[model samples]
Target: MPKNGAPTRTRILDAAEALVIDHGYAATSVDDVIAASASSKGAFFHHFASKQALADALVERYVAADLEMLDSGLAAARAAGPDPAVRAVAFLDHFVGLADGLMGEQSGCLYAAVLTERQLLTSQTSAPIATAIRAWRDGFAALLREALPAGSPIDVDDLADHVFVTFEGAFLLARSTEDPSHLRRQLGVLRALVETALAAGPQEERR
Candidate 1:
C-alpha cells in the first residue's frame, strides 16, 4: 500500500489503462504506470512479473468489464420493455445514458487503444479481446434477431459490427475533439438506427 492505494493491483491496472489510452502501449512504460498509480516498483512487480504480464492483466480486466456491460445493458433493455423492438431500442438507449459518464470519466476505450497497437500484445492477450468483441457481436445479433420480423433482409452480424464500430469511434471522436456531446450524439444515432430497423418490418423492406 502506497499513497492512498491499498488495493494495489486494481490501482496499477487503472493507471495502466489510462496511460495506454493516452499513449500507445509501446510508448507507455512501467515507470509511467508506477508513477500514475502511486505504487512502488515492488508493488508493481509483486502483482505483475513483467510489463507484458501487466498488459495481459489489463486486457483481461477490460474484456471482463466489456462482457459485464453487454450483459447488464441487455438486462436493462429487457427490463425497460417487453416487446423485442422496444427492447432493442432500449438496449442502445441504455448505453446512450451512460455515454456521457463514460466520456467524462474515461475519454477512450482500452479495446480500441490496444487494437491499434496489435503488435504490442501477445496472441494470448489478443485472443480474449477478439473473443470479447465477437461476444458483443453475437449478443447484439441475438437481440436484433428477436427485434426484427421474420424475413428481414438485414444481416444481424453486420449490423452488430456497425454498433461496435460506432461505439468505438464515438469515444475516439469525443476524446480527440474534447467533446462529451459527441459521444452522446453518436450513441443517439445508434438508437435511431435500431428504431429504424424495428419500425421497418421485413415485409415493408420487400416493398
Candidate 2:
C-alpha cells in the first residue's frame, strides 16, 4: 500500500465514480479503477475489500455530500424571512444558484448512476441511496411547510416530490438538448408554483 493511503483511496473513488456515471457499475472493472487512479492493486485492496466494497464506499460518500448540500442550502434559503412567500422565493432563488453551479455536471448524479446498474449492486449500497433520496424529499417537504399557505389543500408530500421530478427532468432535457442553462431556467418556474400555492390559502376548516 502507498504511504498516501487516504489520497490513493480518494483517487480510486473519484475515478470509479466518473466511470460509473458515464459507463455504469457493471461495466467498470477493478483493474479499470486501479489504472484510472494510477494506483496498484495493493493500494486498492488496502482501502477496499473488493469491487463491491468500493461501490458501497462510493454510494456512502455521494449520499453524505448530497445531504450536506440539502441541509446547508435549505438553511441559507430559509434565512430569507419569516414570511412564507419570502421563504419560497428564497428557496427557489438559492436552488437556481445551486443549479447554475451544477450546470454541466448534471450527468453526475450518483443515485442515478447506481440505479442504472442496480442489479450489480448490493442491498448495502441500494438501501442508503433510497434513504438519501427520501431525505431529500422530506427535507423539501419541511421547506414547503414553511413556504406554503398554512392548511392549503395541496398534498405536501406530492408537491415535495415534484422538486426531484423537476431536477431529473431538467437534467435529461439538458443532456439531450446540450443546453446547459435548462436547469436554471426550469428552477425559476418553481417559484411561481409556490407563490400560487401560497396565495391559495387555507381551505374551510373541516367540521
Candidate 3:
C-alpha cells in the first residue's frame, strides 16, 4: 500500500510508467525517473532493488489496474441487460467509448509500448507482461463463452485472441498514422462482427 496521500514509491512508479510510454523502456533511465518523481536516488533504491525490479513493479501495477477497470466495465455490462449477447455487445461498446476518450490525448498503451521493446526487458519484467496479455485474452474469452449462443460456429478462444490482437494493432496504426479514428474504426468493425455472428445463430458456417 502507498503511504500518505501519495507515497514516494508510487510517485516513482507513476513517473516511470509515463516516461516509458513516451520514450521506450530502454531509453528511460533511473535518473530520469528520480528526477521526474522528485525523489532522491536512495529513496528510489529503497523501493526497488534494481531497474529491472522497478520495471517488474510497473508492469504488475499497470496490469492490475487495467484488469480492475475491465472488471468494472464487465459488471456494468451485466447490469445493463439480461440478454448475454446484449451484455457482451455493451461491454465491447464500453471499451470503444474508453478508447475514444483516449484519442484526444494520443496516449498510447503502456503494455503495448513495453511489449514492443521486449528485447530490452529482463526475464523478470517479461513474465508479468506475458501474464497481463494472457489475463486480457482469458477475460475476453470468458465473456464470449457466456455471451455467445450455444453451439454457435464461432470459436470463442480464437475470437478472444483476435480481439486482443486487433486492439494492439489498432493502437499501433493509430499511433503511426497520427489518427485516433483508426482505433475507433477498428473497434466499430469488431462490434459489427460480433453482432453479425450473434444474428447468424448456430446455423452459420464454421469458417
Candidate 4:
C-alpha cells in the first residue's frame, strides 16, 4: 500500500504468514504467497531464495514482533516498581492480549501450523523458532527469579518452561475449539500458579 519495494516485501511476508496459518507450509507454494501478496515472482525471489527461506523469514519476523511487544510492557512494569505478582499479572495481560488477537483470527498461530509439518523446515528454519521459545522462557524465568525471595530454591527455568508449554497448549486448544475462553481459563490457571510459586518462595518476600 506504500507504493514502494519495502512495503512490497512486508506485504509478501504478511500474506505468507496468513497463508501459512490458513493452508500450512507444504500446502502453500511460492505462487500462493505471490498471488496473495499481489507481488511479482521476481519480487518474491528478490526477498527470499525458496519457500523454506520465506517461511524462515516469516517466523523470524513474527518472533521479533512478539518479543518487542513483551519487552515494551514488561520494561514499563519493571520501571514502575510493581511487586512481582503485579508485574507477573501485567506480563500475562500483555501476552494474553496479543494471543487473543491472533486466536480471534480465522487462522491461528502460523508457527503452530507449520509445527504440524515441522519436518518441512530445515534446521536453519527451526533454529529461529527454538531461539524465540528459549528467549521467551528465559525472560519469564528472570521475572520469576526476581519475584522470589533471596536464596529461594525454586527452579525458575523449569517453572518458566512449564508455563510456556502450558500457554502454548492452551492456545492450541483455544484455536482448535474456536473458544477464546479456553485461553482465558488457562491464563487464569497460570496466574494462580505464578502467585503460588512466588508465595511459596520465602516468607520475607513482600510486595
Using lDDT, give the best candidate's number: 1
lDDT of 4 at 45: 93
Candidate 2 local lDDT, 5-50, one digit each (tens) = 6688898998899888777898899999998888999989999999
Ranking by lDDT: 1, 2, 3, 4
Local accuracy of candidate 3 as per-residue lDDT tens digits, 146-205: 887777878887887766676778878887888888777888889899888776667755
lDDT of 2 at 83: 77
As a whole number from 0 to 100, the lDDT of residue 78 in candidate 3 is 80
TM-score of each: 0.92, 0.87, 0.84, 0.81
CA lDDT, every prediction? 0.84, 0.80, 0.79, 0.74
Worst 10 residues of 4 by lDDT: 98-107
lDDT of 1 by residue, 1-207 (tens): 466645989989999999998887889999999999988999999999998899889999999998999998889878976788887788888888888787778868888878777575545677788898898898888889898878778888999887689888888788778887887798798888877887785655435
For residue 24, give model 1's deviation from the true position in Å: 1.0
Q: What TM-score does model 1 achieve against the real structure?
A: 0.92
| Candidate 3 Cα outliers beyond 4 Å, as residue runs | 1-5, 103-106, 118-122, 203-207
> Higher-TM-score candidate among 3 and 4?
3
Clashing pairs in 1: none
What is the C-alpha local distance difference test score of candidate 3?
Answer: 0.79
Superposition error at 60 for model 3 (Å): 0.8
lDDT of 4 by residue, 1-207 (tens): 445566878899988889887777888889999898988999999989888788778888888976786587578557646687667656766655565665565446665766678565545766677777788788888787778767766777887776557667876787678787666677777777777767774546568
lDDT of 4 at 182: 69
